[model samples]
Target chain A: MPHRRSAFFISDRTGITAESLGNTLLTQFDTLEFKRETIPFVDTVEKAQEVAARIMNSADSDQHRPLVFSSIVNPEVRAAIKVDGALCIDFFEAFIGQIEGELVQRASLTVGRAHGMINEEKYDSRIEAVNFSLTHDDGVKLKDLDEADVILVGVSRSGKTPTCLYLALQYGIRAANYPLTPEDLDSPTLPKMLLPFRHKLFGLTIDPVRLHNIRTERRPDSKYASMDNCRFEVNEAESMFRQHGVAFISTTHKSIEEIATNILHKANLKRRF
Target chain B: MPHRRSAFFISDRTGITAESLGNTLLTQFDTLEFKRETIPFVDTVEKAQEVAARIMNSADSDQHRPLVFSSIVNPEVRAAIKVDGALCIDFFEAFIGQIEGELVQRASLTVGRAHGMINEEKYDSRIEAVNFSLTHDDGVKLKDLDEADVILVGVSRSGKTPTCLYLALQYGIRAANYPLTPEDLDSPTLPKMLLPFRHKLFGLTIDPVRLHNIRTERRPDSKYASMDNCRFEVNEAESMFRQHGVAFISTTHKSIEEIATNILHKANLKRRF
Candidate 1:
């Protein structure tokens, strides 16, 4: 066991900003190893003190003090942690004063999604894309899909690539997908590309009516986004999946995360996140 | 802007696991429009309650207790959160006990890398690869390129892919990389592939001596991993970078996180966690 070093990301708001910024900093110290923990969205002195003690407990070298990278905005919370002798690196310490000064001058400032919030939104977008993709997955690249933990098959614009990437980036699952082309939909079977990996295959479906609206956004007045085509594909695709014993999900109203999780759960797979 | 339905991820071990798992679950409930945050590596009741309040504060409806999915290993922490009225779902609640129970009949089962402390060893590998790759990164990529958040140029085994992926995945930066072929090192200012992205480019160099040994592992007697060739390439690459005012890092003992951050910090760019 090498010498143990750890850092705590403590926050007054929700700890998301603290964690994101702190985690990013910790990632930089790859040369110097440190154990990391995030204690988020905490708002009180008692809570802060308790978190301080837990962090202190992790520091076998110091009984009375521990190093903490804190981003608590409240003055009192900061005071409480100080009593614990924590070496906190405040995220806003350098920015707040500058921002307040600017506020006095009334310079316009753009607040981003919460430090944690932005990543979540980006991830959510990917998830939304994935869920939407399941219905349209036609399984084109199933043969060379070494990296994908699972393969999503669906039709055009049914949302596969974004979900695959989401699974890859978020859960470290190598998820590759192929779109369902017209030929595959014209046939009564799942694409032959998926037959070799039937065990890992999953599908997504949607209300043709809803999908038509989504597709129309990208390629309006085209047959690809036409309502009749959307309905035919949805019905044919659902039957094809059923005939082939492939599991599918309706993405009509579900969010990507919901769709992905539901699929993961149904598949009896444990998420790596 | 939506009514914030709250979500939580708590853990007894490093909250990273909890967050990772929680993030996957939170991906579900797309229609619910929830507000979510993670409390990573949280191990105590005090910590759980601490995170619980953050969830409570963010909730929009009085009738709904925030949905919390956590993995605190300590029974005490889980119990504490339960008493506080946060709807908690976690790996501990879902699986730790099952793992313990299984230990009685079966050989101990192990999960993946989260259980390991290999950061230091991996960092060393990355750094060593960096120094070695410098022999390959020509000045072609380092000139006049200003739009790059960061450019990572290296060789076949120089750890460029992992490093680049880490930078983008962890930091949300659009990192583009091009390999330095041996041909570029002989007469190059830099590889032409990189010439267009010059100002944004950063070179990753590693100890040629270490790299030769690494290459030898993959191919026992290949000319590619030879010490003489590595040394010759290393000298030319470093000189090319210097001639073009390209600042570089010897990644002979750094982690992906560290290398990326150093590049970001050195470039005066803000890090995204």
Candidate 2:
């Protein structure tokens, strides 16, 4: 049996960077099972002390030393988190010195700038993309289809909506999705509304069994969730994409981030944020 | 003026971890402007060679050496990215060996597990949260408010929608948001629909000036976008939050991640994924 290790992702801001970096490294060691916790917004020394105490307590309770991934910027606060009984990987301390040396300049040592609210332009664009995605979701608003960075077309439960939302929320891409209904799937040609914007159209396809599983969770024991219907829709959608030369991805074994990033690369769309 | 530098975030998978970690580190050096690009899915030796060529070309064009932040796991592919004239910071190489030594196990050397599709439960939960946030947006579908992990309440354009969406997408939290309309803001008490869910309610406030800016972009010259209306709405919303003792954060200079993380900590909500 694999040993259970406590892992801490500590940051003065969102802690997302710490968490992502830590998770990326941890995946390399498949032999261990990790119990994870994220401690965000540890900007002050008092908060740092609390985080240290929490880490120490968890370390004491655990058989193995806790693994801590930290991205704290303030020297004072960063110093306070160097608790015993844990292997602390201070990402800022590990890399910032090298970066500063390479650039031949001193870092500002400011806290919260990495994920702070200071950049209004970037923030507005992200919010704008979010609004655009929400307004145009599920082909609700089709008049401004050309304005979308990418228009995802697929049958229901093919992972169009989540991929679109991920593109908007993560990369600030103005993504809109058009669900290919049963009628549309049966049609010999592409939908009329999508022809003009073919270059911006991307398609998503999924395995019939996986689609059935997803649809069953939403609406069980119905024709819409039936295996036959899922297979038919997926086959038709994939053929439609191939016939029209629209770039597409299979979402069966891919994460939303993977699908979105692959679509952006294949569609040659630049992320706004 | 500070020199401009070309920055590349390279990864074997989606490049999100590389980009995020790089962006966080680069924020400390505010003096330099970066011409940034993310090269995702560099899982093969040929792709690595192409990325290396691209980086070298950018380095040739740039006055300063390009900074490359990479999270490539494949040793063969990682070797191809060690291009001259670019300061490559290989995240995996820097820390993975130490982690392996600490764990006393060999790494899987897998290409795409960090943000991969292996975890179906976590992926499904994220999609569920996205669907939940969409259905319950702007106080819609309020009958099952108890199902929400966090309920965001704010006035129009106070950033309730994006924050809720972020909470859902990033943390897999079922976040529903209610916009505090003029009618709701005019009253001294909280909305009746939110009374039963007060424990899960998290308010969002923004500077009136910033709110005015955001509203003006959506509904230009309208009463809701006017400065006086913005001021009145913000003041009323904050006062109502205070009167109701609802936990709130100002969205003026904060990112959606910042706002969501703070709310999660304050509300004591657990992430589903």
Candidate 3:
């Protein structure tokens, strides 16, 4: 049997950075099973010590050195978390010195600065983009279609809305999605409303089998969820994409992040970070 | 002035994991300036060689080693990316061997498994949670309120919507948010609509200064954007949180990720990863 290890992601703030980095590292080792936990907002020595005790308890039970991935910036808190029985990999401690040497400057060592409130303008822009996505979802509003960074077109369940939302929330991209209905997919040409903004159009297509399954889950036994309808919609969508010279991707085997990043790359869109 | 270095986030697939982990490490060294780029879909040796050339060019122009953070799983592709004149930190190559030894099993060496379509049920659940958040946003659908994992109550701009979306998209949480209005604030007890779900209620507060700035952007000179109104709303909202014994956090100095993670921790909600 494979050994089960306890992995802790600890940070002074959200612990997202710690978790993302740690999870990436752990994914490479697919043979082991891991029980992961995140301990965020550990900015004080008391909180750090409490976390240390938890780590010790887990290590004692597992009888293996628990892997601790920490991003605590406070020196005192970082020191407090360096308890025995755990193999601590402090991101700041491990790389800050090297980076400082490379840059020929001293780091401020501020707590929570990585994900803290630094710029209100940027935050407002993100919120505005999100509101834009919400308002323009599912072809609801097309008045300011030109303002969108990218306009996604797809069948009802081709993973357009989630991809648009992810792009807006994560990258501050003004994404709007329009669903390609059966009437719109009747012909092999682009829809009339999308012709003027063809340059901003990106298509998402899914496998007919996957689309049928997804649609069946939403509305069981409906004509819209039929295999024949899904197959026709996907085929017509692809032909339209090719005929109109619109770049399209199949979302059957991709995550939302993958689809969003691929769209950004293919469309040469810059992340607003 | 700090020396600027060229940093590349290279990966076999979406490059999100590489970019995220690299960004976190770079944030710790806040004193330096980094010219960042992401090269995704490097699954072949030819593509890896192409990325290697780009890295070498950047290193040559900057007169310093370009930092390459990679999660490429293909051995040939990984070898091609390990070109000289650049400092390569391969996440998969660094740890997979140790993990295989620990587990006593060879990994599958699959590409893009970290963020790929390994499970459709999880994807469907995320989409369902996102739809739930959208429908329940701003108390739009109060029916079946008990189905929510957490219900956030706060002023209009207290950072509720984005946090709910983030929780849903990232953690598969069925989060619903209700904006606290002046009518609700007039009473000392929890809102009648929220009384039945008090155990699932979490509040968000913000500094009046920041709240005024956020509201003023939307409604330029309205009474709702006035500083006095902002102060009254924030103060009353916080007092209501205390009177109702509802847990709350101030979003003045925190990011959306921070607020969402804190809410998950406080509510003791398990992330459906």
Output the number of the TM-score-best candidate: 2
Q: Comparing candidate 1 with candidate 2, which one achieves the higher TM-score?
A: 2
CA lDDT of every candidate = 0.56, 0.88, 0.85
Off by over 4 Å in 3: A29-31, B97-108
Model 3 over residues B1-273: C-alpha lDDT tens digits?
A: 357899999988888767866776677677677999999899999999889999989988898888888887789999998977877777667666665565556767777665453567778888888999999999999998999999999999999998889999999999999999988888788888898999999999999999998999899898999999999999999999998899999988777777888899999997777
For candidate 2, chain B by itself scores a TM value of 0.94
Q: Model 2, range B150-261, lDDT digits (tens) per residue?
A: 8898998888888888888788999999999999987889988889988888888899999998889889999999999999999999899898898889989888788888
Supply the global lDDT for candidate 3: 0.85
Which window of 10 residues has the lowest lDDT sum in candidate 3 chain B?
Answer: B95-104
Misplaced by over 4 Å in model 1 are A1-148, A156-159, A165-172, A205-222, A225-235, A249-266, A269-273, B1-149, B163-171, B207-221, B227-235, B250-261, B269-273
- DockQ score, prediction 2: 0.75
State the TM-score, rounded to 2 decimals, of chain A in model 3.
0.96
Clashing pairs for predicted structure model 3, backbone only? none
Candidate of highest DockQ: 2
Between prediction 2 and prediction 3, the one with superior TM-score is: 2
Model 3 docking category? medium
